[model samples]
Every structure is written in C-alpha cells, then in structure tokens.
Target: MDTPQNTALMRALTELPGPLPARGVIHIAIRHTDRFTVVSNDLAQHPTLSTVAVGLAVRIQSLPQGTEIGIKALAARFPEGEKLIAAALRELEAHGYLQRARTRLPNGRIVTRTVFCNQPAALLRTRVAAARPQQPPAPPQAPALPDVQQEQAPEAPAPQDHAPFVALVPPPTAPRQPSPPLPQPRELTAELDRAATALLSDLRRHASQLVLSESDVRQLAPAVAAWLERDTHPDTIRHTLTNDLPQPLRHPAKLLKHRLTVLLPPPLPGADDLAAPARPRIAVTPFQTCDGCERAFRAPTPGHCRDCRNAHGPAQAAAA
Candidate 1:
C-alpha cells in the first residue's frame, strides 16, 4: 500500500488549500525519525518526489498558524501507520530532498522560527510562481495596431430614402483558425491535478502564515485550477490534481463533493451564476460618468475611460 510519507503527503495534498507559509509551526510527524526531510529534486528524476514536493507545499499553508508537533504524529495521521512515511522520507533525503524547520531553543524552552533548512534557492522562483495568483492570458485578440481606432468613421449618408436607409453592416472578419477542442471531464481532471501540485510548492514558499479562511481558500482555488485546466503539458493535469485536491477535501467525500465538486475548471464556474455578473445597462451612482457624454461608466482597466479621462492628461472641463 502507500507509505507513511506518501500517506502524509497525500493528506497534505488533498486536504490543504494553497501553499505552506514560512510562519507557523510545520510538523513533519514522521514515525521513523524527525531528523529526516521529505523532498523531491528534478536531478534525481523521481516522479513521486515531484508529486510529494507539490503536495507538501500546498498543505503547509493551510495548516493552522502556530500548530506544532513532530515527525511521529504526522506519520500516524494517515493509514498504514508509519511504513511509507519512513521509506519515502529516507529516499527523499538520500536524493538531497529537504524541508523547512522552526526550531525551539537549544533547551526546548521556546519555539523559535529558526531559518529554513535545505530550501534550495535555485528552485524558489518557480515554486513561488506556481502558487501565486496567475492572471489568465487574455484571449488572443486582433494584434494592437498603435493607431487603430475603435470607432470607424460613419459611412457618408447614402442618398436614398428620405429618412435615410441605414446600410446593413457585415461583421468584421478576423483570421479564421479553429480552436482546440475543450478537454473532456477526465482530461480536465488530470490537468488540474498537476497544476494543483505545482501551486502547492509555491504556496509553501510564499505564505507568511498558516490557516487560510474558507473565503480565502475559495479565492485561491480558481487561480490554482485555472493553472491546471488550461495548461497544455502532458503531465500537468495529474500533478496538479495530485497536489491540490485530497488534502483540502480531507473532509468526508460526501461533504467534499457537496462543498467542492471539482478541483479544476477554475476559469469556469461551478455554480450556475458566476463572474462579475452582467454589467448593468444603467450605471449606478457609485460609478463615475463621462464629463463629455454623461454616459455613466466603469473603465475596463483601472485608470479611466478614453472620452472621460485621458491617460496622459486631465479630464477636459465639461458638463457633469
């Protein structure tokens, strides 16, 4: 069956949401030895190593801040007792895999967050990126031509009907290229799994404290899942799911299924209603209005509307 380290890693992977922040007492809880570290490295080229690394990163943060313990408890937390935990952790240590530590005073008088141990600097940036918020690549659009105008000149009025015959306009054409098919549910599942793992590693590195709230958990899920769902890598799905799920949903399957049906598809909404909701046709009072046209508005970007406020300069004095 699965090893204790594997079991611990799995628990961390499935139940935890986001990364393990440097703060908070992270407990390895190995039944074998507290001295051992569980880690995975690319050079060693162990697939399971990578999976474990991803899982650890994700779970570390979700652990409640200030929770403290040791190797034995962690090993016992999962099934199969401590066998897998011992085996896996030893294997990781042999290959230069490592973990962080917050040591107590030499006498064990007080818990002190001693500097991290065995954290490889070279791998850090990548871990951070995986866990951090990722803005989805904007859908490919017409390449920006510096002076291209959104508003084309109104066609000269055609002399015909008295009122004026409005010419039917054809939609503008873009280069036609078929998009790839949406992945099947299974495909989506695997992709998300890998992304989840990667994000876990990053979360562990970046988070300052453990214990994220439910809203906070929900906030990070979409970004993490989006990283998985839309990724093109072959192993991406499995790794992401392996890392992200299992831990956060440590709740009974029924509860987990009811709470979170899926781990991937963050870009897509689980609930029927989602996203910024339809922009109201009529702007609300809190929103600003264009001084020139009096059209109440919210600009797509943070700064301002083109007609109302110029990026380079001030809004032209006009009727409010």
Candidate 2:
C-alpha cells in the first residue's frame, strides 16, 4: 500500500481540483452497453428546430415500428398538450426528420404511414443517387513494378512501337433532357392570376414540403389558375397537391408542376346538352278499378282488391 506507485497516485489526486469550475456544465459520461439510443449531432444540436421537436424526434427514433406517435398518443405519454405535440410533429416533417403518407389499404381503409429519418441528409443523398443514371466504372490499371525490379531486369525488351499504350477513356455521359413545359392556362384574368399566386404561396402553410421559391411560384401560377378556371375548389387543389406526398420530397415545384398538368380537371360544360344528363324520374303505377269489388287500387292491370280476394276465398271455402 505504501509503494512508490501508490504514493505518486495519491500525490496526483491531491494536486487535482476537488471540484470542477463553478461555471459551465460537466458531463460524467458512462459507457452504456444497452438500452441507449444513438442520436446524431445534426438532430441533438439542431440549429433550427425547437427543443421539443428535437426531443420528440429522439423519442420517436428510439421507439419500435408500429408504435403510436400521433399527437394524441404523445400528448397522453408526455406532459405536453396535444397542440404542442402536433406542432412539434409538423416541425419534424418540415425539417425532413419525419414524413407522413396517407395510403389506402386493399380493404378501402385509409391509414397514415409515418417514416422517421435519423439522418435526413444521408437519406436524401441516397435517394438522389438512386434516381441518377448509373455509369459504367472505368477499368482498373495494372500497378507499376518497383524501381529495384526494373533495375534488375534492365535487359527486358521495351514495349514495341506497334504495341503503343492507349489510354482507357470513359464513355461520354448523355446530356440530361429538359422537362416538357407545363400546359398553359386559359386566358387569365387579373383576379384569377392573383388567386393562383396566393394559392401557390400559401401551400407551405398546409404542407411544408411544398414551400416554393418566388420564381417557382411565378412559373406555376398559370397552371393553378387553370384548375381554378375549371371550378375546382381551392381546398380540393390543396388536398391533391399535398396529400400522399413522397418522403424526402426533393423537388416540390417539379411535383406540383406534374400534378397540375396531368391532374387538371376537364373544363366546365359550355352547353346544356354537353352537361351530364339529369337523373331519370321514377314512374308510379296508375290506380285502376278492381274488377271483383269495383274498388280503386294501384295495379298494372285490372285485378281484385285484397278485401274482395279475402271475402271470395272464405265464400268459396264455405261452399266447398
């Protein structure tokens, strides 16, 4: 116990401060072997997200799949209210940490499918790479021999003029073709143009993935006006654009442009004849005089009334 090593350790312990500085936080780190979630610095020290949102994301990432993380479920579990939980979820979605898609089952039931990304940036890169066309890799070249080997084999014949080395060049990549132009709207009015612009700008409020740049809004405004011209309600337009959105939506403007072009409603009928036919009216049976009792009753042909039929049946039975 009184060895030189023990004495040195005791001296070192005494030299160290009894307590850490009275300022900043000190972490007593532990090596956890189990039941610990690994959170990335991007999320743990998020510059833009609120504390609630970051914490919520961590909690969600730790949970198993199919666990309920809905606003109601989270509100029940945590001290936060439903409103706060809902806002935090929206924040996560906006920042690419969460995505919710409404999918219809084979049984015609609609359910919300949620996907959480711990590394949103990595996921985005993966998606982009997958979407890009794959190019053939260049062939590997043989390694050069060491200088010592060359010196030892100085008598070896050099490459002949006929066998001149040719460099291996990669094939040229095809240029990306420009996307086809979006269909133009019918003659736009001042009011229609303003409404369309407003709708495009306001899309972010409903779905944050749809936040468009000013230039994008200007470009896509006419297509939206076309929808309005077809008498499509604003709510309908919003739902169609925002619902069932793909996770990690890389190009919102492009997606919106495609939907506006392809999903455009047919123009309202111009003439009465062009409109859908009116529903057929039901025909009522005509009232006819019963042959047996001279009673008025509904029938396709002259027939005995129920009372007359019953009376005749009893009389016939009595006679029999």
Candidate 3:
C-alpha cells in the first residue's frame, strides 16, 4: 500500500539512513537524532530508498553533449559526495538496478557509464517514444543580422546617389553575448517538471526494490522502458540522471534519494537473509512511569499527569 503520505516510507528512511547521502543535488539529505542518510536516484530497484530520486534524475535531463561528468562535478549538486556514489554504484550493480559499461574516453581513460530507466512497464513504451532525440533550439536564427540594404550605386553616377559617400560598412553591432539565450523557455521547464513528477509517481508504484552501486540509488522506470523497447536503449539513463540531465527535473527527489543511499549498511554474507531490515525507533512514554519526567515515561499519554509534553510539545517530555 503506497500513497502520497506513506508512513512506511518515512519509517524506513528514518531507520536506514546509510544509503541516502547527507547532501547533494542528486541525493536525499535526511537528518535524524542518530545521523544522516543519502540515497541515489541513478541506481535501480532502490526500495525503501527515498523518492527524491525522480526529480534529481529529471534535473540532469539537459546537460550539454560531449561533457563527461565525474564525482567532483556531481558533488556540486547534492550532498552525496564522490565516495558515496562509488559505493552506491556497486550496490546497484549487486541489485541489477544498473548495468556497468566501461568506455574508453578520447584520452584513453576507462570510465563506467550507468543508465537510468524507471518508468512503469505499461508506460515504458510511451516514455521511450517521448524520449527520442530532440533538436536543440534553432539558435534563434542569428537575429536575421538586421539585413541592411547597402544600395550600391554606379561609381560614376555617385553624385546623384546620396553624394556617393556610401561605403559597404557593417552597422555598429550590439554586444555579442545575447543574454545567454533567454535562460531557456519557462514553458519547457514547466513541461519537464510535469513529466518528471508523473514519472516519479509511476516509479513509486512500480519499483519493488532499489538498485545501488556503491551507494547511488538508480530509479527503475527507464530500465522498464529499455527492457520493453530495444529501439530506445537505456544505456544512458544512469549518466543522464547523474551528470548529463538538465535542471528543474532533477529537483528534490533525486537529491533526497542520494541522501538516503549514504546511510546504507555494508552487505551481509550469504543469500541476503542475514541482512536485517532496519526498524523505526519511536519514543513512547510508558504507562506507569512518573508523569512528570516520563522516563521511559510511564504516564498515560493525554492524561496531563506530569510530562512537559502536557506543558510544552509532544516530542519533549519533562516534569510538569
């Protein structure tokens, strides 16, 4: 039973803070009395991992092509530093959330690439259909260069043609940097946001487990689509979400998910049964303790017998 306000989700994260990164754009930063958690949206099947993965993935949707991102560049966005990503990547590999493919860069350095594909099975085809390579905006037609008519006149008849002093010189130009292409279209940003939110909702419903590599949690939607549509191979989902995607789409979800992955514990031996699941620690007041300072507090709640909870807030207990 998943819902918009899933208590189980909150409890799960509060207990296992390791997988989530404490900070970063593509991570989830969850602070508790004990420590921090970082989760990775780039990893697959990340269950109990934070939902922040979706927005972060979408955020990296429009990175410029030919740019290779590393851990340092990633740290600028989310709290999940490079170390956590390395760990998450391995964890995801273990869970089959991502497939690790090594590529030889132009400099001959081998680098691993991860793909993210977290769409629902039913919608994967639709998503892939939508994810076809889109052309970048047409450079605004170079503003037409204000085509000025030079009106070249015969050399001998120049006296009658504006005193023949017309020279074919270009007009004084405005500053070259045209204000950075108007910061992209607001409509496009909103569109991506809508798409990301929808995909996120779909993911929350379909993902049964989370995939982690080292520690980054990859979403499973794009993978679903890839599995269904060979034409839209999901080879780049991982890197796109982590380093190549644009802004807006990679909002809080991914950043939060990354934060969650940081809190994951080391792998247990054998067939995964030894891996005990974490449980939430809720502070409860005992039924028979002093009402004043409910130490393990034995006062019946709502009785106002003695704890500061009666006087102050429900979270803190003190003598009344």
Candidate 4:
C-alpha cells in the first residue's frame, strides 16, 4: 500500500515562528538552532516585514528540499492564508532571503524559479550557483537482455549553446514623480501689517506687562503670521502671550518676541501630505488619457479631449 501523507509533518512545518521570541509566554519548547543564520538589525527590524513575513521566512527555512512549495498550496496550510503568505514571500525576497529568477534550461526552455537561502548569500556566490548546471544521475546497468530484439535506450536531447544567466526579479518601479512645487503664498502687505499691529495692541490691554509700541507690532506681525502658519490659532497666541506674566512691568515686548521666535511650532502639512498614501500604492487604470489635453478621460480609442472632439468631431468622422 502507498504510504499515507504525514499530517503531523505538515502541521509542524506550517507552524514555525520567526527569529524573534514570542511575548508573555513561558515556552515548553523553542525553535532553537545552533546553525541559524544571523540577520542584520536593519533586516530584522525592517518596517516592511511584519509578523506574517517572519513566519513565512521561518517556514521556508524549516521545510525540506523538493517540498511542494507555492503560494496557493502554502496558503491552505497556514492560518493567515495565501494573500498574507504571498505578501510575506515578496517581503522575504526583497530582504535577501529569497530571489526569483527566470532561467533558460539546456533544453532551450525558460522557467521561472525562486532561489532560497537560509543566510544572506553574496551576489557572486548566488550567480555562480544559479549558473552551475545540474547533471542527471547515471542510470544503473540493466540485466543482460536476450540478444533477440533488445531495444537501445533513447538518446537524450543535445544541450543548447551556453548563455549567461540573467536575474529576472522585477526592476525597481519608477520613483513617484514628486508633487508639483507649491506656489508661494501671497506676500504680506501694509494692510495685513496694520492688522497684525492691532492684534498685538489689543494684547497689551489684557496684560499691563505686554508693552508693545506701533513699531514693535510691524516687526512682530511677520512673526505672528509664522505662528499662524504653524497652526496656532490667533486667540491661542493672544492667551499664551497675555495669560502668563511676571508681576513687574518690564520689557515685555522683548519677552513676547522671544516666545514667538523661540517657541514657534512646526509648520502644518500641505495638500500633498493629505493626498499621499501611507504605503506604496500602485494602481492600474483602464481609462485612457485625452490625446489633445493629455489628461485622463473616458474613451474607447483614438482618445481626444471633449473640447477637441466637440470642435473637430471624431477622427473617424473627420476621415470619412
């Protein structure tokens, strides 16, 4: 009878943890190895590699050679399933644990395969290993056959001409075109300068210590505008300047100016900050861009802007 598949082996293989220790548990057994690969702090704590990635790495390391390893098959065996496993595998490949390459065989067939490494191997070593040809094992001699009608073994296909191996990992994607530079905000003017003067003048009445002359306000207006740019409300600035004070009347203008300049908060994020995605976001759109306007617009083919189409009519109609 054919041997039954080992369910226990499958379970043990799927449930391995990463290099990190689990929290808040006294371990009955630890997945310890004397010959385990030592990873760098940067690789171990990489932001892209999550717990799912760690588990996948561990699983890949523990599995025996020639085991049926694929995203679909591994997904069924793990709790996190295929999507997580696939993502984790990609993470592992990115971090030097695995490399996917499309290689041409001696038979002129191209196959995509992943090279797994328990430790980070040098690029030269990896290339050399991948380039090295794997030879078929020698066949055992058969018992002497009868002279009558003994058939000769079929000849193996001739090996193709040698070619250099090429790594087929997807190229690094194009960097995000930086957001268009922001237009400078309008420059401060005399009217706005007067408004700032009024703001500081009003503050002196609240606290006798806040002594600011008209000249001081003109100098201080730009600083106040900077505070506003940092997201400090006008009322809050007033309260901060007037509420806390030394009892004696002194050079309060200098003190207030010092607070404004020294304690300035960080600038608020711009429109781009809100628009940007938290992680690398890639999207493929079906809509084509308008030929005339060069902006994305709905179209079947020979895409033209609405204005161009309306004015010139469809290219087909124009041609006809």
Worst 10 residues of 2 by lDDT: 163-172
What's the CA error at residue 289 for candidate 1, in Å?
99
Question: What is the lDDT, from 0 to 100, of the residue 217 in candidate 2?
Answer: 93
lDDT of each: 0.44, 0.83, 0.41, 0.66
Clash pairs, candidate 2, are none
Q: Evaluate model 3: give its lDDT.
A: 0.41
RMSD of each: 38.0, 15.4, 34.2, 26.7
Name the top TM-score candidate: 2
Sliding window of 10 residues with minimal summed lDDT for model 3: 178-187
Q: What is the Cα-based TM-score of model 1?
A: 0.19
- Residues 1-320, model 2: lDDT tens digits: 56998787666655665675768854445589999999989999999999999999999988988998888888888899999999999999999888887655654345787888787776666556656989999999998767864455556788674422222222234476677677677788999899999999999999988989999998999888889988899999999888878778999998899778767777877798687989999999999898887989988888888888888998999999
Model 1 per-residue lDDT tens digits across residues 1-320 = 76987987868755655576678765544375644444435433445555453443333333455543234654555442465555544544444444333332433233433112233433444455545889989888896565565666676988784432222222234366553332233343554645544554444233322234455444444445544455434355334333323223333323222222343334544465655577669854466566666676765434345754563354234422
Query: Which segments of model 1 are wrong by more than 4 Å?
Result: 1-61, 90-97, 100-320
Clash totals for all candidate models: 43, 0, 119, 0
TM-score of 2: 0.40
Give all TM-scores, in the order shown: 0.19, 0.40, 0.20, 0.28
- Mark the regions of model 4 whose C-alpha exceeds 4 Å error after superposition: 1-186, 229-231, 275-278, 281-320
The runs of at least 3 residues in candidate 2 whose Cα sits more than 4 Å from the true structure, single-residue gaps closed, are 1-23, 144-320
Candidate 1: worst-modelled 10 consecutive residues by lDDT? 163-172
Residue range 1-320, candidate 4, lDDT tens digits: 23345665555545766553656633335466775644445455657678778767777666767665678767777677788788888888887877765544544344557777654634445566766798899999987765667677777999996544344442244366553322121466665556556778888678776777778876778777666656678788887677546446468777677567555666788899879577866865468778778877766665777887786776668699
